[model samples]
Target: MLARSIIFLLLSLSACPLFAQQKYIMTVRGKVKADAIGRTLAHEHIVTNFIGAATVVDVPGDDSVVIAKILPQLLRLKGQGINTLIECTPNFIGRNPALLKKLSELSDLNIVTNTGLYSAVDKKYLPPYAFTENAAGIASRWEAEWTNGIGGTGIRPGFIKLGAGSSALDSIEAKMLAAAILLSRKSLLPIAIHSGSGQAAISAFEQLKKSNWKPEKLIWVHAQNGTDEERAMLANEGVWISLDGVSEKSWEQYAGMILFLKKRNMLHRLLISHDDGWAVLENGSYNKLDLFENGNSIPYSTLFTKLLPALKKAGVTESEIDMILRNNTGDCFSF
Candidate 1:
């Protein structure tokens, strides 16, 4: 047993980067640590609006109203011991480095931001240039966001995000995905994909594999909505499965899948996130807007009060939760 353990350790060490180091912009008191990883909501739009890049002329609100709306939620998340959040807001709307920096300073929450283009449900809503933009153009912008920082603040993004159309991967979206993979490989950044229902997760992975991208470098988000067989396949490839439940109807629906992965010793690569945001008021307005008006109301408190407790009740150990939240998240963006 001792010899076997030693061999395993050696192999693990060999797989890790030779000059492994903990790289992060800011750190919190109790939560941020190089070794910390558990219960990370691998899929969450920390600050985002439903309309996204589209003009929301109907939404009655300015920047201040949005920030005020989401402040409480950020405060709540801070209190919840949710060490880190991989905010999957792409460059155009969701990338707010200054505001994120302020939130980290004020809330002490580790907000890992992402870079890349968004794949909207409706192509008609996308930017006029987005449809005609070639893969190289998208990739150049993505690379700029990572190296030079979004909008020239020099605040580098932590990960790359790619999404398909609400229904399937369209030609333009596929080009964007391929471009994202190319840029991510060059920058050594991990890629996260929005796999909306059906075999989206599997298809995305298949595309990545075809591009010769390693599975470990990709995170297939919304695994909770995927079929059992698809989830199992992702687990086998050592891909991270984000079993987001916040927006999903029932968190319990994912419990079985979580248990299955755990039983199969695949829990290390799993993540759980709420994917929820500010409440939609009766008048059809969203509260909790951030600096860029892309904010949500699902504060840290929600994670601690509702989400964490629910998972605990579902038999998730604190250590395991830490792995999902802290360790796995850190690993995802180690590049």
Candidate 2:
């Protein structure tokens, strides 16, 4: 009787959601429990290169200079209570997993990276193979990155990052979205698309439905680009709406959007961040880093310093703010 009781207790505990069904969020260092990431910035970048994918190459000695420039910014962000930052720079646009890993360790911040190709900006960031490869073939490449780790760095991506133009998904963007759906289905990772407009977001969401993908797993990044009606429509359809471009100049705009969603009771579907980062520049024979001209003079600090206070002043309760910054972010990226 004693032995049977002990066995049953052990089995019950093993079958509990906290054990058998544990959810995790992958970061550059490794996997962590979903709830462990606190006060996450869902969309941000570390460094980016706009030199076009055709001729862009990672300079061998640029890592040190990058660290020197960006690490202090991250440390300051850490000081402001940001526990995790989802680095949005895709592969060709300076997605440096190894550098992100080192920064994560040094800053003691959980940094998440992504797997996917960028198809916006007239497909300038896309590699030649992206055009040649079929949807399945492109998905296979992203899957391999997810499975084997990106660039053999032993660091896996936590989500899929993609981009599309303002009008609609062009053929290549459509193919990229199809591949993202395939990979998301296989890996259960969320897809964050840099949508340029409401129409573009609608186009992608429609495609996702046709593929039978879960709407909750699709994050419409830059949802601020869409109207309140469009945001509400997509949020009602269970898509995660990311208003990531919060800056000092745009806090009122963001506050209005947040209040709009809050009035509609769609705050649970919302995520916010300052889409801030540094851009790599070519100067003479050496590479230089420049702050992105996004109007946030400080990278990663506007949300806490400017937006949060404004949201609070506008009657957003602490719990609701927490939901947007912590809960929604964790749920959107966790698998």
Candidate 3:
């Protein structure tokens, strides 16, 4: 049956005169055709950086430290059939593009890196420079990175990211968001906002509207906490509504969200993931990383191991499943 399916796909594709002009996912290494991106985790952190983290927590040091902790998880994600993953850890708070390139090379799976700043955690996460920079100045920073490369690593970003504070965007967070919209307008890469709650998510959406940016270009991350009406409204506007609730505690909730999307006929705009990441191992050393939960990053295997079966049991069809895990995610990355 598989052989027949492959042959049928080949025959169908060969019949299309415009097949070669098809767009594909933009990865750290290069472009990838859609078919090659088998299944994707839309909002995951293969490697998370937590610099200036409040309280006491482990923050991985240099590239070696991060690679030592995250490479195994990348390979494990590949083993579990996740062909592509998006690393949403933004700048300052430990966004490492070079490490992402290396991991992609070693694991032979497509890993995408992002540009922009994160401000959801606290004002401290916002760099000192962010405080003084105007919106255009901040945008120029991201634009330069996108045009050239971030930190001289020569690794360009695949998407724009912003972390809006809970309930609203503070002054600096709002500036970063403005930069995100401007970047999207210039580069056509979609923007993902780590919104804190329903009100904050809606406020960001209103800002996007005010800026005349297409609603489709906005992705409201962490929107799972929003009311059903709010989520549906955003989904109705064609924005990507990401419900990244993939852990032992939230797996059932994740499945329920999928069922909700299916019922509302909004699965095409839905993005799902563990939102989990490999821990920033203490001291850049890998002495048995029992700290996977230390950084809110569960194993990459959570989606494939725990959630897939539950989604199936919840009456999600194979085609719908493929659309959520692969197609929607691939669409999210198509630059």
**In TM-score terms, which candidate is top?**
2
The global Cα lDDT (0 to 1) of model 3 is 0.78
lDDT of each: 0.65, 0.91, 0.78
Higher-ranked by lDDT: 1 or 3: 3
Model 2 is weakest, by summed lDDT over 10 consecutive residues, at: 278-287
Better of 2 and 3 by lDDT: 2
Q: Local error of candidate 2 at 209, Å?
A: 0.7
lDDT of 2 by residue, 20-95 (tens): 7777899999998888899999999988888889878875654777787788999998888889999999988878
Model 1 lDDT tens row, 31-53: 24445533355666545544545
- State the lDDT at 56 in candidate 1: 28
Q: What number of clashing residue pairs does each candidate have, in the order they appear? A: 28, 0, 1
Q: Runs in model 3 with CA error above 4 Å?
A: 1-22, 53-69, 281-298
Residue-level error in angstroms, candidate 3, position 25: 3.0
lDDT by residue (131-228, candidate 3, tens digit) is 89888998999999888888787888889888887777777777888988988898888899998798888888888899999888888898787877
TM-scores vs. true structure, each candidate: 0.78, 0.93, 0.85
